[model samples]
Target chain A: MTSNSPVGQDFWDELRRTTQARIGLGRTGTALPTRRVLELAGAHAAARDAVHIPLDVERLAAQVREIGIGEPVLATSRASSRDEYLRRPDLGRQPAPGTDIPESGADIGLVLADGLSPTALDRHGAALLAELVSWLRDRYTLAPPIIATQARVGLGDHLGAAARVRTLLVIIGERPGLSVSDSLGIYLTHLPRPGRTDADRNCISNIHPPDGLGYARAAQVAAGLVEGARALGRSGVDLKDRSRTEALGPPSGSEPGIQPGHSPRRR
Target chain B: MIHRQQVSGVTYAFDGLVEVMAKATPLRSGDQLAGCAAESDGERAAAGWVLADLPLEVFLNEEIVPYDTDEVTRLIIDGHDRSAFSAISHLTVGGLRDWLMEMAAHDHGAEHLAAVAPGLTPEMVAAVSKIMRNQDLIAVSAAVQVTTAFRTTIGTHGTLATRLQPNHPTDDPRGIAAAVLDGLLLGCGDAVIGINPATDSPQATADLLHLLDAIRTRYDIPAQSCVLSHITTTLGLVEAGAPVDLVFQSIAGTEGANAAFGVNLQLLREGNEAVRSLGRGTVGDNVMYLETGQGSALSSGTHLGVGGAPVDQQTLETRAYAVARDLRPLLVNTVVGFIGPEYLYDGKQIIRAGLEDHFCGKLLGLPMGVDVCYTNHAEADQNDMDSLLTLLAAARVPFVIAVPGADDVMLGYQSLSFHDVLTTRRTLGLRPAPEFDAWLRRVGIVDDAGRLTPFDPTTSPLRSLASAVAP
Candidate 1:
């Protein structure tokens, strides 16, 4: 059998060990080695599972209660079923009827929803919220985490407007990938409402560890973002994540004029 | 900066102001044949591979960059170390072209250049890919639509197909059905008579599907139709029992990009299964149709970091592979030039990307096709698509989309025209999917020898009705 890993196979292996990219998974007898192929197949399954597996919302709610941080107001999006959430994205953004909320306004409306990767919330949702709650508990009036099922970043708008908060801090699971599945994202919007577009928010992505920001650091950045959005009068392209050195993709502040967050228009 | 404005009234000198509007011009479209020599069956067959074998990869170069570039050559001799590309990190497009041409001469032009460039920028490799003519790697994978007695495979040897895009200004069925008849008269609709509905409403999309389904049943046309709207809308249409032969989705390399299109792998599978479960694939199991290109990962911000190398195009290609590998699509199109010159500069770039994407998609074992198209605002013309389409045909590319009169009024771009399909069939001895071919023959559009004869549309049933539906 002929090896397709190039002549200096060891050198590529050395580089491979340093990063998670699919660089040096050497080929065996024309195709990828069976072991590596299986490994990839496993990774694909894990990523898909991260997306398809329903979140233990009860477990997540219990953890939030145990932490004694923020309170809880549970709700679902217009997408009642998992199938609808996956396809009708617009429904995921609109607030469903009968969401229990506080009539009085709060300083900050904390919303935790399942983004594309439910596993992200399963792993990091409780911890990130606890830290965020710990930091902002003294300075501002914090509402409980308004748990939403099948939610998008814009879902926080409806909750925030209903809660009558000056700002909405949404910590949701970001879309999963082949290498890193389960990374969470935080979107902060100033005066979020039902009709507010993505242009009204700012995103700090990759908010989990190993390849993402740590929970504490992510919380620290979220706090700073809340402060900045208040000072700047708006979010979205106006707000930026400058509390620390960036880790993945473009940092928040660099985008100009365009809606630098997730695409607002549905395809 | 010199501003060439013929203003004799006053001499205005401005420093650092070019007065040029900053626009990331959109990508161009179309694959057509404005001029070509007529040919007989034997003559056309002799010119190119008329009976080309399936899944052929003639241009498989094991050594991607075999030229005497100091960086790669050093790596070959220095026992392979890091920083091999440090000395040659950035080069002009011309400089990159020279190196690539030298490698192409050595029969080793398969280098994945994004593997070693700086993370933020990898345009040189992108430019090189756009320019390199991957003539060696020709491939063909075909899909068939079965009828009562026989079946015909699309992209088989001696065949090409086109999707008739009948779009309406108001998402109204009247105007759209007219255009469908107009295209069918020109020997189009072999690929699939699809529509790009003007609105995004699920009801409208589904209604268009039902209208087309009724038309197909009424005419007894042995062809497939698609409403190239979002898959959710298509799924709704399918559940409503509309005759949806193909469910369409615009796919990107990364999962995030796909989320924008309301698509995930699971949903894609569900849509495919839904269509299959309904027995809608009676003609073929080729159910799902996908559209992809470079830079979707970067644009969607889901592109993984390749250490420090540029990851946009490479990651995007792999992402397409991931989707294709999972779904086993009936048709996959890498709309190369649709993204504009900012991503792909000109004809050379568009042509090169079309081949690379086709090669990569086929390598991932999907039935790959090319939407040889460009946007009106892009820096391209029909001449560009003409060259690209001809090369793809010569390479025996499996399938391409077709529009009427080189213009898709609905999509607002030009694509492979009915003229291009006729040219491909006449000049390369390529035929349409067999069932569609038989339908065309029965309509007396083509003779028994499979040659398209001059058809008097006034005498025909549907083409004449097109005049009523059309302006």
Candidate 2:
């Protein structure tokens, strides 16, 4: 329909005014430069390079052993078509049968994946992994390094459940932006299992080279989630509630100074 | 830094500074190379791609190296080359930009080629322009392909954005319903309220009643002023079935009187003629919702089921004119509170684009510079209220927003408060009746006292309403 329709015209005029007002406000300081974009692109290029190089599977296996990882599981899948992947999100989340883990009970199940941004892996994977490993070592004993290729963020649930781990933390590439195409995202789940919802997971994103969320920080956050999940007996919404309570100090109810569930009785 | 090697009738002076030359000379023409070459009997050949006619001025670190043309040709034929000629050839215009940047770092001639190429003589410029254009096209195509590939990769794995997931249980279905409802609500709030008006089957009628009950008890909403819109097929209107009149009578005192159903005519037209027969006398306060068809006034092809009619700015205006004309009779005869077009699909670009037209201006034109515009379903948030206010202000139309439930009503009030703070006055108003209160109760937002609270404003239930009004 034409813009002259009552609603159409109103929406146009309002959108224009809102956009103008936002521009006039200049709120975000001229949009900070995004380093993640560059790193993501660089990482993608590196991943392509790695794919082309004659990969020594044996060498990769040796590296896994060196890290003291036990037998790790692997998985892969392809989009129905390249275009279908882009236009329809409903199709993207459907995991192949064997790809999903049945249950999770391990201390920590590490999953490697090529998310929306495969290039992110090449750029930040090494540093992020190193950081995650080092910090995780300080907290809990990790199981074998579970490297799942071509995985989505949700895959962590299955992997965690299958490994029967207390927690599953997935490191995957994020979708590339025009500027920062190769950023990594970490998804952590406590008591991971299939059918776990988004609220059940926590994410630390924009992990890339040079000033992104490093592995050490990610590991700390992940460890907190695992420990909290163990205490709360749940993750996602429940975990968030517990964490918030801890951070904010028990909602002001347990204190002797205040009564429960009422705004402190006004004087 | 200079070294000399003599071979056959040529004495080649090679600088020790050049590593490639030093390695090349000993293997090709040296006495040690001759002995080894004789023993191998041409069974093994030197590796790397060889340049047959090496440009004389080509230098490696200020060193000069000599090559035997025949030997270089043989080496090239043997498929031993280190040059990146193939990589360069595959480079498109975008690729060439990178290639040129790399080359210009060390080669002045390459720098000159990049500099002069943009503004060269007619013939040379034309050829360069053609290549650049082709390369640009290729780059665009590749970008599209890459985006598609990324989407496919994510979709096949079922890992699309979490936002699109169903909003129920832990998820918020109100937010989801609001998104669908907002498209209908856009400019009108006081004039319309969406009802679950299903009269199709006994089961569907029961579902509608249950929904009505939920809206009533949950949010404390009044029933008289609202209209029901159904996404599913219309229930058959039989005596034993839940007659619309009987249903209204049943919840007459409660907020049920305000509700009406949204009809899906396309689906109803296919059902047993009995359903269509019900439409003859059954159409009362209920709206006849029909999207535009081709050859109609509004003709933008963007709308989902408008029979491929274009629904851009002009077409939207024309559609408004047509709606004003055709629906006026039905509205006047029925004494309905309002008449509206069936729901507009997302991204129609019409309502936002056509507010200035006299057709809409005159139709909605009210006294005191205030038009009684109805927003079908709106989120209760400052930004949503601000957006609606801004749109209304632009049209000089004072508007009301129909909140589906109590949470929405609270947010709507909060949005009003925010608007007062931000705009120095409240230009928009909230109209949440008992029907909305009932919905609130169903959704667990309101307590016995009819109060609601959301935990996080950024990700609050209130914000879900705001998204419904998002452009």
Candidate 3:
């Protein structure tokens, strides 16, 4: 970042250390400096490439099996191709008709899908699944993990229904940003079924490693949400993530009861 | 009435008004997804030709979204100013286009356009936009100006404002403060200092609102602050005495789509009344901040038009302006390209949608701004955004959203940066909102002539802001 006054450089430096925001970039008559412009271009190139990259489902399944969570079951969303997946979101939320998924009726279901950023799912999916399953298996019966291709967040609903699990946790790659292209996200839904709106799910996003949410913290948050969902008999807007406030425990002293659905708001 | 046209010995007939409108819309991925887009360019041209010949009064008679099913439609039909419409009462859709172009070219065109703004329906506005070229949209939009005020006046000629979006992934107060300080040094945030919280919890929203209020009051900056949360969250916060300058909601065109958003006309009305009753304004009481986008209705599975036919996304987007106009919002912007590539596939489609939204909103009498942005998955880059930003600036859009470096870490999208805004303003000889410009000079962020001074963060008056949030 260029500073017009060299004296202010140190203060800006101190401030820049606090946030991920690009704060101190020096301007050249309303244009960004040469390096900053090129930096953004380079970042955008990576992110744009990440969106089109396909996840290697066989490799990801092998990686998940190595983690010893459960036998990885291969699956595909109704969207046959990436182009179709991007255009028709409705198709991405459902499993392809007649696809076989053995129903174990386990207490928890896990699905690893290649969302917008398959590269992210390919890179971090196994590690995150391993971390999250460690916190989940001892307390609940785990079903076979489903590896979904060309999926959206809602794909978990169909896969979870097929598994007949009480709760579904979808660990997927989030849409890439210029700053962080490989960030992963976890979505939790209780009693997963079709027709459940975003209100019926709670999201834990931006979980890449080192710089983003570390694996331990992300697993902790997911376990907390799973526990909260089981206690409340539901998820979505009614369930709050108190993982940051306290350790996962009983629902006593926590507001875990059915409440009316709250509307979704975003920028 | 049957809508048909002949193209090279081919008879193209549409099922109804909605079908005609949909087929005539500039090609976009959203309409194609909905199975309503024209099958060929010849069909689209034929449909446009038919749409142009339809009388302006057809909008008054035909409903795109059924009136009984959608309150937004009811608002347009009920609130239409017939007296104001009398000026253009006899014009066809094509006639209205020619008239607008002629008036825009005249010295006194702005007055004529403003005079009839109240009479125009969103359908009429959307229809004319479908027939107009990008340059026509720009020229007509530039001729019309709609202004609003809270602490600063916006939409005055020779001025462009920005909504400083200081978002953080975890809502860390110190991180937010740093970004806000950066924007202030660049003379941004003249439209409003708004935040899109990661979570919609009322408590978190209230805390951010409080943080912004504290900064706004401490520096006595001539601007308003908003925490964009659900209307219910904002309403509860208002009841609990939170510092709310603007009540925000992402409204849609149809009642079902809005209901999916967990909002309705009544809820918005209540929120508007609740925020206004707080008496938090120095310049005016325009407290509502409304946002709309093209594909929200279709995304929600609620974009039905006449005979259950799918309405074009752009028409649905314009109908949202009817909702915004009724609320008397201080700011109404379409988060144009934020919905991803499914709706607006590429740079050409995104730019066209941005201009169309701004044009329709201005013609319908709203202080419209555009979030000139794109998601990474969308086939767009910084160059696309630069093109859109320059075009919108040329159209004299009331405001644009500006992040620190065009990368919104929290929202995970790209938008115009502070430097981008400065570049547009300097290149176009525009200033910030009047009060914000005065405050900038008073605080030494800009010179006496309202030009940005070399920012010296160490001696800057805004150093107090850093210290306040400093650990």
Give the per-residue Cα lDDT of candidate 3 at A189. Answer: 92
Task: For residues B1-471, write the lDDT of model 2, one tens digit per residue.
Answer: 434444444444422222222122111111121121112212111100111112211221121112232221122223322242333334333344444334434435333332332221111111112222222322211111000110011011111110001111111223323422222121112122223221223453444334333432343322312122232323343334433311111000001111221222223333323332345221232222221111121111122112221112222222222222222111110100111111211112112212222112122211101111211111112333344334433322222222211012211111121112113212222222233334445544434444332212223343333333322
User: What Cα-based lDDT does every candidate model obtain?
Assistant: 0.59, 0.32, 0.88
Residue B107 of model 3, lDDT score: 96
lDDT by residue (B233-281, candidate 1, tens digit) is: 8888777777787878887754556776667767888998898676555
Candidate 3, clashing residue pairs? A2-A26
Flag regions of model 2 displaced more than 4 Å: A1-66, A78-105, A138-141, A241-267, B1-471
Cα error of candidate 1 at position B191, Å: 1.7
lDDT of 1 at B433: 70
Arrange candidates by DockQ, descending: 3, 2, 1
Better of 1 and 2 by DockQ: 2
Error of 1 at B459 (Å): 1.6
Could you give the DockQ of candidate 2? Answer: 0.02
Model 3, backbone clash pairs (residues 3+ apart or across chains), number: 1
Which structure among the candidates has the greatest DockQ?
3
How far is A220's C-alpha from truth in model 1 (Å)?
A: 45
Q: Return the candidate ranking by TM-score, descending.
A: 3, 1, 2
- lDDT value for candidate 3? 0.88
Model 2: per-residue Cα lDDT over A80-188, one tens digit each: 5433332233334445565645343447778766665555665566566666777677667676665554456776666676678887778776644323456677777
Chain B alone, model 2: TM-score? 0.28
